[model samples]
Target chain A: MSPSERHNVTVHGPADGQPMMFAHGFGCDQAMWRFVWPAFSDEYRVVLFDHVGYGGSDAAAFDRHRHATLDGYAADVLAICDELALDDVVFVGHSVSAMIGVLAAAARPERFARLVLVGPSPRYLDDEGYVGGFSEEDIADLLESLESNYLGWSSTMAPVIMGNPERPELARELTNSFCRTDPEIAAAFARATFLADNRQDLERVRTPALVLQASDDAIAPRPVGEFVHDRLPDSRLVLLSATGHCPNLSAPEETVAAIKTYLAR
Target chain B: MTIPAALLDESAEDLFETAPCGYLTTAVDGRFLRVNRTFEEMAGREREDLLGKRRFQDLLTVGGRIYHETHLAPLLRMQGSVREIAVDLVRPDGSRLPALVNSVLRYDEAGRPAVIRTTVFDATDRRRYEQELLHARRREQEVALELQRSLLAGALTEGEGLELGVAYHPADKGLEVGGDWYDAFWLVPEETIAVVVGDVVGRGLAAAATMGQLRSALRALASTGFEPGALLEALSEFSRRHELGQMATVAYAEIDVRLGLMRYACAGHPPPVVVEPAKPARLASDGRSPPLDAYSFWTDRPDASLQLPPGGMVVFYSDGLIERSDRPLQAGLDELLASVDELRDARPDTVASSLAQAAAGTTGSPDDVCVLALRRRPART
Candidate 1:
């Protein structure tokens, strides 16, 4: 379908610089990248937007079944890339979006220059031979918390759910209302994000990838991070001494520095 | 500045005897050679009754006695020290008390095991805390259910110009009702009507409370005949004063029954879907302005004229209807748009029931879906 006449997107940054697409996690919108954007905006064309239901987007367009798969989110990323006419794009996803970016890259490897996955996981569920750090009950508690108040969970859980409980605002700082999303949409996302097994998809990620890991994370532990690194054919793992699911919020400078160091090469 | 090893070793007996933790030394034959005041307090017996008479195993509860006879003593004999092992002791009154035990075997000069010294601490507070946490979660679940009931009540009220129907389903059994809401009621007889579907930031009681405030404010401002934008502006002003960190997105539909036309406004919300008998594509609302409360140099249009057939239904809803738990909000919207024709495909006599069916149960619902289905009830020809 042609772009909706009412839909208009503005891409602002250096026109000829390395382009990067950054996706936010649950409970947040594109604004989560604000602090990290300043470090690269002068040099790179940065892309950010609320997920369809969140932020300043149209909410009525949201559908439950179609979006139950991460591939749908992956398709949205590619659509945004296509709209911008981006090539050799450096795709960066934070938290869950990081996993979405990996799936997107695996689908269309040629469109991406490198994949910068921050706190990414192939699957959150523990398999017979695999450990995802959290048990079923742990995720149930998290879902219950999210259902109670996504913002409250983000603010309160950011401390314990992330590596550091001291900086609770980091959770509050990264959130966006973009999806203007319904609780139903959030619930669907939670089930798809947590219960779905995507271990098979990691093997197809052929693009040179950088897994910028937080030393301590509540959702993605070192083992899960390493599992992603080991599975991706062309990847490097760099664990920074950051303590949160959102490194972009917890350690913006260090995260930016890592991005700078990786992109520079 | 530090005490010498010999002095420290010699003073260990004095320190252990006076330490806040319960300490006791048992012989190889299981007789208690020494017992501290802390141990005496733990057992509810005097040191004189305990020392040189009771065995370490005798103080353990029945289950603890079995565990000690089969597992603990053997483990401690093999490992030298077992720190922080949880156990239960039977006090003199036969009340079982939970505790954590740390023990090490004392050695003679030649390194032979002479006696076993153990330390125990009360774990009642920790156990109580765990129980309270479980209870708090249970109480929260009940509160979430109550919020859901209130969210569903009076959500769809009919007015002179409009007929309304709404349904709300929290994601799960005990989830807090999210901020999604749909409402249509007459604030001023046939002259004016209020129709709105808006989403407050976050979910649960806080969002529900804010929803009530915003919804009530809209109704309060409705009689003044403020246009949708002006109405939203008033709401924004109120929110700014209250300093609600969360923002709200709303789509408002106002009908002037006497004029036979309706005006619509959108603020950071999805456009309302206008459904007619046998026509789906023929109906759609123009979306404008980002949601209210996020400060920007944006203005809202007060009116857009629309001819209404008496039996036509205009659906006003929060994002929950089309929201997918796992996908971007847009994808969910797209899916919803694709299924818009389904609303029209139903039997005309049962359209109201069909619309209710769409949102009745949340099989595919990820969030709370609030839809206000309004029918003009065309003239009886």
Candidate 2:
């Protein structure tokens, strides 16, 4: 399948406008940017897509080895950019995707002009002097939680909500909202997201970046955000009053305003 | 028979305090705002210690807390409600309560989420049942896999002037084992080798069991010195009479190394490929018939013969090797032919592995694949 088909890429706004691509976090699809993407649609070409195995993207394209790390995801980003012939792109990434954007920009510096990272953590596990929060045991507990929730999700929601012609509304609402994925893929993505150590990759990213951190995010704490900022050579940190990991969903206005201010600069 | 009005006159506050399920309210960020008596009892904490001091996530295990942040919180924010979310709440005394939680996000007038109302239900029995089901499914998968491995085990007949190799790969997606099987054994003392590759019609334990039955039947029929076509004819009758392996497709071949002769039959399977020395590999498209049990009455199965020159090879493979969802059948066949032609100079085992690896590729295939190759060594002077 073509990369566009594999990632389920959807494009909006003027055909000639500057491209602004939004990549969602680990838990959800591109719909996580529902409220934020529209705010820039008129001025920027808004690009949205589901990661393979997440939303409408072809689940058959999910290769365990190909998607074993964040680099595989970054390759998808580059593929999208190449397929669309996009240049000087403005990339917005949430949670785990923020590091993916970093990897993409580091690989092909000319394709990206700026990166907006929301609630990103370079390393989730705590190190000797650094406080990334959580531990090895905590990550194991998180995997167990994911497995149980996936079980509940597949058993209760997948059969009735997925591809049911009688309940179009439910399917529409769930098109991107906690949509079902293969449990093994979900676990693999969780491992790739939490257990990753990409602290060194930040130094290689020459693109100007904006770090949007939520004040009280349990997933990506304030110090972790600061750690990411300190590593990037040309990045600024803005701590929003938003109190959760997903300010894009919880505080869309603040999230939009921060991105608009950074782009304006 | 209705209860008296006076007896049913319980106040809303009383009901809230003494409901059967634990009830609590929290801020949008999960900070505990109000806790009912039932909730306090369930958590084993005093109201003063719980209220305004603890967030809903604070009561969960580390894993449950992560789930709250990643799945539950995002879901509630998107859908305004989340139901039947399984979580383990760590009690004040260091014990755990397996609970099913339902929470709704209440928005203030400005359209901002202001409060969350949650209900927790004890789900110890349900959780246990679910775990048992999961365990049962895993055990079934393990048994099926083990059965497949044991049935395919044993060394292929190896002797002077002959070499054989086989490769088998199951689908990697689900727990159910697939129905692809391959076998090679000595039909005569040292002159001929019988090779077979077949695919049954289903998946899981039933498919594996059917494959085993068909494999055994084929070996038994071959042992009676039946020709390639006659053995398949009997195998089809065995499937119909036993009501097993309906619509199964198999390819059988007998290679006579001393005479450099190969007789093969295909029952609704891809024709075998032949790679001769100093020539491109090509598929043999003759001797084909419908799958086993495809018709109520059977016709005589036809056999085709080819003369394998010195240093010639023959490949028998399941349909998966030449069928992919993304490409046409002819395209896949052409790719296989090309891959085989490239490995003409490799050893028998190397060629078999290369063909299987090339067909399966890096991505996991949707179906199982099996490849069995036999080569006739040049006659020594």
How would you encode candidate 1's per-residue C-alpha lDDT over A1-265 as one tens digit per residue? 2112102233558999878777777554666676687888888887776565454444434545446788877777877777768899988887678888888888888899998898887777777999876566645644543343333233343234233323434433442222223555566776767776788888888889999888756568889899989998998899988654666764678999998899889
**Could you tell me how far off, in angstroms, the CA of residue B288 lies in candidate 1 after the best superposition?**
1.6
Q: lDDT tens digits, residues B1-381, model 2?
A: 999997587899878888888899999889898888888877888789988888899999987887788778888888788888889889878998888899999999998789999999888888888889888989999999999988888777788878888888776456688899988878887888788889999998899999999999998999997778878889999999999999999999888888888898999888889999998999988888889988989758999999999889998888878787778899888988988988887888888888777666545367877888888997788
B1-381 per-residue lDDT for model 1 (tens digits)? 988786566466677767888988888535788888788888788878877877777776543443443234434544465655556677878786777778888879996668988889998786567558757866776775576466546534545545556555455322466777666677557655667888888776677778878877777877786776777777777777786624688888777655557777777777776666666533345646666668744455455557666667666666766665446876756655555556654433244345434643433354666666666755655
Clashing pairs in 2: none
Best by lDDT: 2
The complex in candidate 2 yields a DockQ of 0.57
My TM-score estimates for the predictions, one after another, are 0.45, 0.95
Task: Score each candidate by Cα lDDT.
Answer: 0.66, 0.86
Query: Which 10-residue window of candidate 2 chain B scores lowest in summed lDDT?
Result: B357-366
Docking class of 2: medium
- Model 1 Cα displacement at A97 (Å)? 32
lDDT for A190 (candidate 1): 69
